[model samples]
Every structure is written in C-alpha cells, then in structure tokens.
Target chain A: MDYFRQAWAIAWKDILSELRTRQMISSVLLFCLLVMVIFSFTFDPGAEYVSELVPGILWVAFCFAGTLGLERSWGAEQENRAVDGLLLSPMDRSAIFLGKALGNLVFMLAVELVTFPLAAVLFGVSFLDVWGKVALVAVLATAGFMAVGTLLSAITVNTKLREILLPILLFPILVPVILAAVKSTGSLLQGEGWEGISSWVKLLAAFDVIFITVAILTFEYVVEE
Target chain B: MEPSLRRNLLGLATFMMIEAAIFMIFIWAPTEQVMGIVQRIFYFHVSCGMTTFLAFFIVFLASILYLWKKDKKWDIVAHASAELGVLFCTLVLLSGPIWARPIWGTWWTWDARLTTSLVLWLIYVAYLMLRSASRGSERRTRFAAVFGIVGFVDVPLVYLSIHWWRTIHPVVIKPSGIGLAPPMLYTFLVSWAAITILYFYLLGLRIRIGKLSEGVEELKAIQYSGV
Candidate 1:
C-alpha cells in the first residue's frame, strides 16, 4: 500500500506539472494529428483498403508521438537536476520507474484518445462499433510501450545522442508490441470480435508482463550513478 | 602458455578448421538434388546463424555478470560480445538473402527466421551504438549492461511474435528441416564447429583491444594528474 501510494505520488507529480504547463501533452497531440494528416495524404482516404491501412497508421502515429513524449518526460527531469532530487527521495528506485512509466502511459493514452476518433473521421472508418476493442488494444500495447520506453528513456537521457538514441534502442525491442497491436487493432476494426483477436491480446499481455517486470528489475541500474 | 602463444594457437586452429570446413563444403559434400549449387551457402549461413546466437548468449551472460559483479571486465566482455554478435548477425542477414534470392525466388520474404534475424540485428547494432554514444562514463557501462540484458530477453519474444505474424503472410519457406545426407551433415558439423571457433577467436581479439584501450585511457589519466 505504501509503495503504491509512493508510486502514485510520483505519477501525480508529473501529471500535475503537465496540467500546469500542458506543454508535453499538447505537442504530442499535435504531432499525432500531423501524422494522421500526412499519412492520409499518402493514400486515398476513401479507398476500400483504407480500413486495412488505418491500424498501421494509427500505431505509427502513436509510436512516433509516444517517442516524443518519452523524450520530454525524461528531459523534464534533467532540467534543474530534478532527477537528482527524485533519486534522493526516500522511495525505492523501482517506484520512481513505475511512477514515470505510469505518467507516460497516461500521457500517451490521452494523445491516443484524441487521435483515435480523429483518425476514424479523417480515414472515413467507423471505429464506433469496435471502439472498446480498439481502446483495449491501445491500452495494452501502450502499457508495454511505456514500460520499455520509460527504461530506455532513462538510459538515453545520459547519452550523447539523447533524442535519437531512444528510438534506435527502442523500436527493435518494440517490434513485438507494435506488430501485436497493429494486428489486434486491424482485426478489431474489421469487426472481428474477441475470439479473432484473442491471440494478439495474449501476446500483448505477455509483453506487458515480461517487460514491466524487466524494467522494474533493471531500473535501479539505469538510474544509479 | 604465454598470452601471445595462446592467441596464436587459437588463430591457427581457427584458420585450419575454416579451411577444412570450406573444403568439405565445396568438394566433399554432395550437392543437393533440388536447390543445386545454391544449397551450399546454407552451410556457412547456418553456421553463422548459430554463431550469432552464441555471441548474443555470451552478451546476455556477461551483461548479467556485469550488473551482478559490477566489474569492468564483465562490461568489456559484454561490449565485445555485442560487437561480435552484430558482426555475425550481419553475415547471417547478408547470406540469408543471397541464398533466398536463388532458392526462394525473392530477395526477402517476411519469413519468421528472416524477420527474427533482422530484428536481432537491429537490436544489437543499437547496443553497439549505445556503447559508442556513452563513450567515457561508468554510467554508460551500466546503461549498456541494462540494455544488453533487455535486448537479449526480447529476442525470444520477438521470434514468437514474428512466427505468429508469419502465419497470416503465406510462409514462403516452410523450413521443413532439409534432409541432410551423411556427407552434407558432416560438412555442416565441421562448418558449425569452425564458425564457433572463429567467433571465440574474434571475441578474444576484441576483448584484447578493449583492455588495451582501457590501459591507454588509464595512462592518459595518470599523465594528466601528474601521478
């Protein structure tokens, strides 16, 4: 209970800061919207195959925008040596990791919330029927993404190539999450119900469990000097 | 034995073994009835593939030890092994398409093994890049160790996810365990053994280079400090 409270407190700190400035969320949201517009131009949005392309486009947008958000999320801590303060806090290092990951998850999901409906409208697909299923897939994939992203973000924050290094280190390991998410979302959008997407859901769930565990275990090493 | 003598012996052994393996592959092993001459690339390709996996496993083990022991030696081993892993992985990726273009009639198909190797290649190349980017810090070593472990742990998951994804794409190559003839099997064994030795030899060379650089850095530090 204490650990959960500590983690929540740290998450709330980030959330509250974002609420005050709205800098990270707004930029990430706008970036996601731009991705939608650019991708929409590449293919005929009215074409029959547009539905098939929507999931991949949606995931690409999420991942790219999520990468941006991740950089800022850690980059914020770098300012004023704030991460040092976090380190000096009484909470466990893994708690800090959990908190940061949770904060990232919330921010990315918020971006997804606005982007999903906008994507449906722009691409001329009615995700209205499968909205819940799509949301489920998004949440699962984003959770795993955040878990890994948070860890990698910490690792990259200290590197010379801080911004570029995250994606290079991140995307390969993230292939499974992206593949599973896109598959699940594609199927769900096609009106394939729970039974059709069950396997992908399992993969996403397994990714979430494995990576969150690994991140929690290794977070201490990344943050410690 | 002296370190130089040991290294020379290892180098000699690797050279002789590789020569013997090449001779066996080209002259001794019977050509496949189906794929013909192109099938021979399979000997080195598969051997390199195995060596790639072995190199990565070394990175994983050394990474865990690095974190556990907090030893610079372990970090050097992990970094050196990751570089060698990327090298072997590149060989696998290159030879794969060379064999595939003739046999499968495509330069690439999203086959499970092909996709997994590509992803693995990307992962370790990123590992090496991370090491280079974080050149001079102890923190860099720790971060690299963390990624080393994370990257390796992701490999099987990457493979499993890709294998499942390949079910939707019509699998171009069924990977039905090519039935090796007696001589073909012997040649493959010899090639595999030779490549494994080459990996170790290359790894030894890399580790020596890493230690020498560390020594140079220490000497420079001492000179600056007037110690």
Candidate 2:
C-alpha cells in the first residue's frame, strides 16, 4: 500500500514537472514527427504499402524518441544530485523505478496520442480498425521496455561512459521485446485477428512480468553505493 | 595453477588424439551404405555442435555462481567457457557450411539450426566485445554476468527454433526424427566424451593463465608504486 503511494507520488512529481516545462513531451513529439516525415520522403510508395509499413515506422519512431526522453528523464536526476535525496526517503528503491517507468510510459503515450492521429493523416490508414490493437502493442511494449529501461538507466547512471553505454547494453537485452512487438503489430495491421496475435501479446506480457519482477528484486542492488 | 592439474590437461590432450583416431577409423574404415565419404564430416560437425552447447551451459552455470558469490574466480571460469564455446561454435558453423556445400546444394539457408547458430554467434561475439570494452575487473565481471544471464535465454529459444520455424537439418537422431544406427550412435558418443574432456582441460588452463596474468599485473603495480 505504501509502495503504491510512493510510486504515485513519484509519478505525480514527474507529471507535474512535465506539465510546467513540457520539455519531455515536446522533444519526444518533435522527434517522432520528424521521423515520420523522413520516413515519408524515404519511401516512394502506394497507400497500401505505406499503411503496411506504418506500424513498424510508428514503433521505430516511438523507440528512438522514447530513448531520448528516458536519457533526459534521468539526466536531470543525476545533474541535480536529487537521486540521493530520493534514495534517502522511506520508500523502497524499487518504487522509484516504478514511478519513473510510469512517468516515462505516460510521456511516451502522450507522444503516441499525437503521432497516431498524424500517422493516420500522413499514411492514409483507417485508425478505427487498428487503434485498439496498436494501443495494446504500445502498452505492452512500453511496459516491457521501460521496466528494463528504468533499471538499466539507473545502473548506467553511475558509469563513466554512461551516455554511450546505456543503449549498447539496453538494446541487445531488449531484442525479444522489439521482435515480439513488431511481429504482433505487423500481424494486427495485416488484418489478423486477436487469435493470430495472441501469442505475441502473451510474449510481451510475459516479458513485462518477468523483467518487472527482476527489476524490483534487483533495483536495490543497482542504487546501492 | 596446480602442477598435477596441468599434467592432467596434457594427458587429456593425448586421450583426445586417441579418440580422434578411433572416430576417424569408424568413419573411414566403414563402407558407406547410402552417402559417400562426405557423410564422414557429419561426425565431427554434429559432435562439435553438441560440445558448443555444453560449453555454453557451463558458461551459464559459472555466471550464476559468479553473481551469487561475487567471486572473481568464477568470473574467470565463465569467461573461459564463453571463449571456448565461441571457438567450438565457430567449428560447428564452419564445418556445417562445408558439409552443406557438398550435400545441401548451397552454403547457407534460413534453416532453424543454421539461423540460431548465427544468432548465437552474434550474441557471444557481442558478449566478448562488451567484456573487452569495460575498464576494470569488477566492472567487467558485473556487466558480463548480467549479460551472461540474459544472453543465455536465447539458447533454449534457439533449440526450440526448429519447432517454431522451418529447418533443413536432419532431426533423425533426435526423437522428432528417425534414430541413427548403433555404430553411428556409438561413434558419436565416443567423440562427444572426447570433446567434453578436452573442453574442461582447455577451460582449466585458460582460467589458470587468466589468474596468473592478474597476479602479474598486481605485482607490476606494487613494483611501480613501491608500496
């Protein structure tokens, strides 16, 4: 119960920061929009092909943009030396992970909220049919990625080569999530029903569950001096 | 680092040669019923693939031990096993392509076994690269242990990849396919045992060398610092 309160407190802290400054959302949204535009120019294609590739393009944009936000999310904590303040608090350290993950997830979801509509307009696709499935993929992938990402971000914060090292360490470990997301989202966009995409959904869910448990158990170690 | 274990490793190498001779005779001395002399390559190829798997499994165990104990010695063993696993995996990959060139018509295909081996190679190569790029002993061990645990998750996935995807590798020796004849089975067992012994002997030597290198570095630091 206290963990939930702590998590929500941290989440609200991040949310309130974003509301005042709007830095995270704006940066992520701009990066995502730029990617979509670049992708549009890179590929000369019919509407059919564009729609087919849009799911992948959207996720790729989300992934790269999400990294930008995440790196900054912790950048401030490290710069301000506020992590020690948070760590000294009475909350479990894993609660900080959950809070940050939720914060990042909300920021990503907000960016996607804008990107989805633009993707529909830009790619000439019917969002009504695909939105729910896309959202499902987004939630699971975000949960899985941030679950590992937050812990890894915390771990990398103390390293000397952190700026370059996090992605190198994070990407290989996150391959399964990316592969599962791409496959499931591709299947859904291809008009495959839940029955076809169920396994991937399960895979994403399993990955989220496994890593969240691991991050919770291991977060204490990562933050310890 | 013990004198007797070093001697045991030399003896292990001798036995490996003997087993290699026996394996060769079994392949060459026997007349082919179906495939020609090319089929002989299968003995070394398949046995080496199994040996690679065994070495990686040792890596997994050693990694878990290292993490649990935070001992540098176990990290040395884990590092050694990963090196040997990559070595034998390379053998499996090279021999597989060679055996295929004569038999499977092409050098490579997207078969499950071959694809998974390629992925395994990529994963371990990345592992080695990550280890090389780290600065200190503790940092290297911690990062490698985490990667070792996560990277091994690919092994079971690779093993089951054939069921999940298409593969042209013969599954006959496996329960999923027809079993091999007794002589072929016996010869394979002999080679597997030989390779297993040789792997441990090599792993022990490598770990000993690594410890000695670390010791030399410590001595150099003391001499320079005059401490």
Candidate 3:
C-alpha cells in the first residue's frame, strides 16, 4: 500500500509537472509527425509496399521520437537536482523508479495515440480494423522501450553528452522490441490478425516482463551517489 | 608458478595450438560436401561468433558480481571482456559477409543470426562508449555494470525474436548433427578449442594492461598531489 502510494505520488508529480509545461509531449508529437512526413516522401510504395513497410516506418518514427520524450522525462528532476531529495525521502527507491516509468509510459502512450491516427491520415490506411491489436503492440513495445530507456536515462541524465548517449545505449538493447513490434505490427496491418502475430506477441510480452522487473529491481543503483 | 613463466607457457601453448588449428583446417580436414573451400571459413567464423557470445556472457557475470560486491576488479573484468567481445563480434560480422558473398550469393541478407550478431556488436560498442563517456570512477563503474547486465538480458530475447521473425533464412549453426563428416568435425572441434584458448590469452593481456594503466594513473595522482 505504501509502495503504491509512493509510486503514485511520484508518477503524479511527473504528470502534473508535464501538464504545467506540456514541453515533452509537444516536442515528441511534432518529432513523430515530421518523421512520418519525411519517410512518406521517400518512397511512394503502392498499397502493397505501404502494407509491408508501414509498421517498420511507424516503429522508426516512434523509436526516434520516443527518444526525445524519454530524454526529457527526467529532465525536470535532473535540472532541479531533486533526485537527491527523492532519494532522501523514506520511500523505497523502486517506487520512484516505478512512478517515473509509469509517468513516462503515460506520456509516451499519448504521443503514440496521436501518431497512429496521424500516420493513418498521412499514409492513407484504415487503422480502424486493427487499432486494438496495434495498440496492444504499442503498449507492450513502448513499455519495454521505456523500461530500459528510463533506467538508461537516469544513468545518462547526469552526463554532459546525455542526448547522444541515451539512444546509443537504448537502441542496441532494444533490437528485440523493435523486431517483435515491427514484425507483429506488420502482420496486424496486413490483416493477418492475432493468429499470425501470436509468437511476436509472446516475445514482446516476455521482453516487457523481464525488462520491467529488471529495471524496477536494479534502478536503485542507477540513482545512488 | 611465477607470473612471467605462466604467461610464457600460456603464450607458447596458444601459438602452437593456433598453428595446429590452421594446419588441421587446411591440410587435414576434408573439403565440405557443398560449399568446398568457402566452408573452411565457417570454422573460425563460427568459433569467433561463439567466442564473442562467451566474452559478453563473462561481461554479464562480471557486471552482476560487481554490483553485488561493489568491487573494482569485477568492473575491470567486465570492461576487459567487453573490449574482447567487441573485437570478436567485429570478426563475426565481417566473416559473415565474406562467407555469405561466396555461399549465400549475396553480401548480406536479413538473416536472423547475422542480424542478431550485428545487434550484439552494437550493444557492446554502446557499453564501451558508456564507459568512456562517464567521468566519475564509482558512477562510471556502476553505470557500466548496470548497462552490461541489461544488454546481456536483451541478447537471448534478440535471438528469439529474430528467430521467430523469419523462417526462410538459412540456419547458420546447429549444435547437434546437421551432418559434418568425421574429419571436418574434428577440425571444427580443434579450432573451437584453439579460439577458446586465444580468448583467455587475450583476456589475460587485456586485464593486465587495464591494471597497469590504473597503476600509472595512481602514480600520476601521487606525483601531482601529495598522496
């Protein structure tokens, strides 16, 4: 109960702070839009190409844009040097990790929500048929991404070259998420349904569970002095 | 035994074994059924690939142990292992393409093994970059350890996801008999053993260099400030 409360408090802190500024969301949203617009121009693949490649394109956007959001997720705490204050509080450090990760997830999901609809418009595809499946993939993949992302963000946050450092550390470790999500989403977009993507879904789930648990357990060391 | 004597013996053993492996590969082993001479590269390529994985696994274990014990030696081992892993992974990636160009009729394909090995290489490169980017010794060591652990945990998942993602790709390796003739099998085993020894030989050199550099740094600190 106390852990939940503590985590919720930290998450709410991030949310309320973001609501005040809206900086992270707008930048990430715009970045996603720009990526979509740019990639759409590179190849005017017929309906076949779009179906085959849209998932990879969308994931690429999310990967690039998601980094922007994650980079700023801990920006406020870092800028204020409030991690020490949070660490000093009697609450478990894992709670803080959970709260921050939850908060990042919420922000990331919001970006994806808008990105999906906009991508549908920009690319001229019907997302209604597979929205649910796509959303499931998004949720799982994004959680896995931010699980390691948030942890690495905390590690890199104190560094001078954090912006470059985050993606280098995050992306290579994220190959599985990208592979599973893009593969699964590709099948979903092509109307293959859940039957086709079950294996990928399992991989995504395994990745999410393993990484989230690890990030929660090990995050204390990342923030300690 | 004295350190130098042990090192000399180890060096001699590694050199002789490597020479034997080469001789066995070219002179002793029968030509492979399908791929002919191109198949010969598979011996060292596959061994290096496996060695890279082994090296990174050492980094993983060292990372966990470092965090558990808060020891500097584990950090050094983790760093040394990552350095070697990256080198071996580079060879794996390079040799994959060279071998592929001849056998697979293409320089590269999105084959699962190749894709995952490239990712493995990138992850350890990130590990090295992370080590160099951070300044504080304690913070640097801790960050590298955590990243090392996380990167390793991703490795199996990387393999599984890539495996599931594709079915048409050629299977590059199998532990049990997909069928290698007796002499080919013996040469493969010998090459693997030689590479494994080479890994340890390089590891001892790398770790000692790391320690020597640290000692020099300490000496400089003592000279500059009143240690």
lDDT of 2 by residue, B99-192 (tens): 6887788899888788777777766776676677666667777767766766675455334523344667877576575376766766666676
For model 2, the stretches where C-alpha displacement exceeds 4 angstroms are A157-163, B1-7, B14-26, B29-41, B100-106, B154-169, B176-178
* lDDT (Cα, tens digit) per residue for candidate 1, span A3-56: 989999999999999999998888888888898888888986588899899999
- TM per candidate: 0.97, 0.85, 0.96
Stretch of 10 with least lDDT, candidate 3 chain A:
A44-53
What is the lDDT of every predicted structure here? 0.90, 0.76, 0.87
Candidate 1 recovers a fraction of native contacts equal to 0.81
Error of 1 at B26 (Å): 0.6
- Chain A only: TM-score per candidate: 0.98, 0.95, 0.95
In the predicted model 1, the residue pairs found to clash are none
> Which one wins on DockQ?
1
Error of 3 at A116 (Å): 1.1
Model 1 spans with C-alpha error above 4 angstroms: B167-178
Task: Order the candidates by TM-score, highest first.
Answer: 1, 3, 2
